[model samples]
Target: MDLTVTDLACARGGVTVLERVNFRLAAGAALILRGPNGIGKTTLLRTVAGLQPAVAGDVSMAPESVAYAAHADGLKATLTVAENLAFWAAIYGTDEVSRAMERMNLAALADRQAQNLSAGQKRRLGLARLLVTGRPLWVLDEPTVSLDVASVALFGTVVREHLASGGSALMATHIDLGLAEAEVLDLTPCRARSPASAGPGTDDDPFAGVTA
Candidate 1:
């Protein structure tokens, strides 16, 4: 499935932060969102993922086809690594738990509880949930936050494999991950105007005192 966004306007804290956002991510492709911090990148991803409503415009895709991963790991602290994967596998109706563990290099720590794992290990486990989701589009925000150099490279390989299998990814990140084929979409131009200085209804101030 392909992901498409046209003339999207999104808000954070009831204030618009991004507008005129447009993009199309076809199957087997990846699109990287680049912009400085607090530039509405997270807000855009959340809106696209359907976590929140768009202030205006359209996001074209089946909601079930998307798998969203945000800054939070969304892990079960008491569950073991393998168990966590198994839980997610059950939710997505996939039996790829073992495959996900091996792919994220978590097989060695399968029996360890999520809370007992190191930060990077936990991050890997959190990311492994994407594999079990069985969804075509991956919407990720800062996926490599806690990953080390080697782990980042490993994740890059996993992303490539996913694309090779006709999956699509829309991510917001500063790290390279070495995705040479991924197209870049800078959100600078899409920054919403502020509310203070404007005409009757035009919010032209980009800095609206809200975090993206």
Candidate 2:
């Protein structure tokens, strides 16, 4: 599945954060977004994931073809590693928990409660959900958070395998994970130039304020 974003715009609190964002990710490839904090990297990812609407332009991709993983590991602390994967697999209508665990090197901790796992372990578990999603496109926000060096390497390998299998990914991260080949998009240039003091829709504003 390929992703195409044309003249896209993103906003927070009705204020445009990034504008004219555009990119195309072919299948079996990855696009890494790089920028400073609060630069709308996550916002763009969310818009592409269909979790939120694009403030303008177009995001061309089937919603169901995307699997999104946010910064927070949305895991059930009480559930075991295997159990957590199992739940997501059920929702995704796939029985690939065992393979997902193996792919992320979580087989050894399958029975451990999610809450007991260290930060790195938990992050891996969160990533494992992508495997069971059966979706071709992954939109990840800071997927490397809490991951150790080795775990980051493991994640790169997993991503490579996914691409080899005709999948794609869009990731926002500050560190390089040694991907085989990935296009890097710097969001700094995409930052909206309007000053904060300007009210929405006041002038060339996408979120211009309403008036009588």
Counting clashing residue pairs in each candidate, in order, gives 4, 4
**Candidate 1 local lDDT, 188-207, one digit each (tens):** 87777765644574455443
lDDT of all predictions: 0.88, 0.86
- For every model shown, what is its TM-score relative to the native structure? 0.92, 0.89
lDDT of 2 by residue, 1-212 (tens): 77888878899878889887778899988889887889888888888988888889888877699999988888999999999999999999999999999989999999999999999999999999999999999999989899989899999889889999999989988778778588888877677767665466545644331110
Ten contiguous residues with the weakest lDDT in model 2: 203-212
How big is the RMSD of model 2? 5.5
Please report, as a residue range, the 10-residue window in candidate 1 with the lowest summed lDDT. Answer: 203-212
